[model samples]
Target: MTIAAIIVNYGTGKLILDHLIQIREELATVPGSHLYIVDNLSPNGDAALLTEGTTGMDDVTVIGAPRNGGFSYGNNRGFDQAIADGGYDHYYLLNPDAYPRPGCLKALLAFMAEHPKAGLVGSRLEGLDGHIQSSAFRFMSLESEFASAAKLGIFNRLFASKRVARPPQDEAHKTDWVCGASMLLTAEALEKVGLMDEKYFLYFEEVDFQRAIIKAGFEIWYVPSAHAIHLVGQSTDMKDGKQSAGTAPDYWYDSRRYYFEKNHGAAFADKADRAWAWGKRAGGLKSLLKGQGLSSVDRDIAGLEAARKRAAS
Candidate 1:
């Protein structure tokens, strides 16, 4: 019944510290729980500032990482520490920008205990306004990847069932992966999967880890009843719901290339780049006839091409 709730923090120190305060009530409802924060060597020294929130909480512990190893590395530090501490039956990974609604953590712990096969479960994420953010998903395939980047309605129709991204379902359902923002992992499953891969600087780390979890013979579920509010892009410097070139950063492209090349192979990564490039062109042509720029076609073809080439090198 004991669980470790881990948060990975970068420059978002006080933000996550405030998050710790918000979850205090939920933690009390559980049989046993502890909070672990991994400070990823924030250049601004926000790591030192975060200690104010731990004031009188004996269950809270902080790990000061020697370097910034990105999202996966930071979370893995807490994961390893929790397992070493022993007696913890579950691990909950929450984004610094996320806080569970009342009874949210309880719902995840109760569900995992009820279903021994659900190795990992994710909370249903809603924004501050209570609108469901897309978190649960089908596993990515060439079809889904191409369909998502294509910006063509036909591709979506062709690959509707295989689509990789999906919103949280109204009912609980088994899924390929859930957003890392709020995931609960069982101790047995963590023992098998080890820890989150550090190779990912930021993106796709959860997808890769969840894929490995499934391969290790465990199910992942999206639990709608476990509600959490996530203000997207708090730590990553992305906002306004626009993640275009302006928001795209170097680590993101690097992570994207690494995920595809490491998991699917270099050749497959190149194929994905070409697929999106072709899809972008097709959409551009459609826009030309309408006398307008292609709309919402946000694929960064040049950046992806560069990443694909870097992976091949």
Candidate 2:
């Protein structure tokens, strides 16, 4: 089956070009597969650089986006082009900073082939240090919101079922959603769910898209056998693995707000927000009693408030 591999590039020009040969080689495993690189009007002139770098690569095509419309927009551009050129059997979304391990592409393809109901399958993501990242997740919920904000062991245990980040799976299994960094989407699923919601602009687009896939009577799977090394935060400059101040930009909060309001309704989203605010207060009180500072927690609250103001206006 022919596969269309789409890599959305922002300012990661040199990084993506570095992995081009390896990505192309991985695609070669499946005959007739081609690579489409969508440059999202990178401020550093990455579009031109990517174009010149892939000059002689017959299987690679670079699409320069007229404006930088974020991740979903860039991938949709590649998807639209793929549909126009020739509909592909499958569409693979890979981050510009992510490199799939050997056999990753084939493994995902095999899983999809065996499970006709799986609309999307994602590979286990690894860090440069070889640690497994949280690739699978449950959908967001009120319990998860409180548990995450509380950051306490008791809350996590109390709301274990609703925890957003699922533990690393030992084998292929169904999940609510998988990381977008290295997901393979069936053309059938795309035909059913359509392109990702461009309103997201960045984060939560994959979660929204996968949620739609599930609602449309399809399954989402996590295949640990298929692996990819993802340089998390390289594309967005937001380090998620650490607890740091100012790591989350305004768009993150905007996307979070949109995801909740669009999927769960305004009242439910408001309740979720209140649950998180209460949890944060509880967590901060505990930290203060322990002689620890609440700088990070306070910053998070302020950021959310600012985002709310922007949305209201």
Candidate 3:
């Protein structure tokens, strides 16, 4: 089966180039493959460099979007193009900052081939140092949302939460959702589930897409044999430097509320939203009581409340 690899890029030229080089070497063993890079109007001129560098590869195609479409819309444009172009049985959605191991794609594709019911399969993700990262998760319900808001879900166990929670870890195990960093989806699955919801902008888009895929009767699988190293937060850190105020929190919180409201009900969304707001208020109050000063927690709480109100309405 033909496979098309799609990378949605927004700056980080060096990382993207490195990822493509590694992918090219890996693709040599897996023939009838194509690579497409979609650049979302990065200000650093990385798009031009990517377009020029990847032009030499016969299977590579590059498209530059007019503006930043976030992950969903930007990746969707290339995905739709690849699907229309035909000859591809699967589409690999990869982040610019993620680099697949030598046999990662082959392993994932083999798993997909064996499991026809799995529309989406994600690899075990590790950091640069090879430490495990949480790439698969259960669907977020009110209880799960509350636990996370309270930082009591798995933060206590930290990296071992996946093991402690006993999240499916096998050659092929079903999951509610997998991280979008390096997910492979069958073309048929794409046709059935439609494209990623652009309204998500950044966070929670994968969760929303996986929800739709499951609703459409497709299973999401986590393949432990395949692996990829993801430089998580690359885009977010680039957008708002490491030390800057948390400018991207609103997008995340809003998207979370949107997903909860759309899938569950307003009550679930309301409870999660209130919990998040209360968490922020308590944090801010604790800071004041300790003479540490508020760190914009009040403003964050107000924003989350506004988002909750909008979602409820």
Q: Highest lDDT: give the candidate number.
A: 2
Give the distance in Å from residue 164's predicted Cα in candidate 1 to where it truly belongs: 1.4
CA lDDT, every prediction? 0.82, 0.90, 0.77
Residue 131 deviation, candidate 3, in Å? 0.5
Instruction: Sort all candidates by TM-score, best to worst.
Output: 2, 1, 3
Q: List candidate 3 stretches off by more than 4 Å.
A: 152-171, 238-244, 281-291, 309-313
Decide which is better by lDDT, 1 or 2.
2
Best by TM-score: 2
Please provide, for model 3 over 104-190, each residue's C-alpha lDDT reduced to its tens digit, 9 standing for 90 to 100: 989988888788899999999888897888777877654444344344424335434333123536556788889888999988888
Q: Kindly give the number of clashing pairs for every candidate.
A: 0, 0, 0
TM-score of every model?
Answer: 0.91, 0.95, 0.87
Minimal lDDT window, size 10, model 3: 159-168
lDDT of 2: 0.90
Higher-lDDT candidate of 2 and 3: 2
Residue-wise C-alpha lDDT for candidate 2, range 102-158, written one tens digit per residue: 899999999998999999999999998999999999998998888888888999999
lDDT of 1 by residue, 207-260 (tens): 999999999999999999999999888777665323544535656667878887
Ranking by lDDT: 2, 1, 3
Off by over 4 Å in 1: 239-247, 286-299
**Which candidate, 1 or 3, would have the higher lDDT against the true structure?**
1
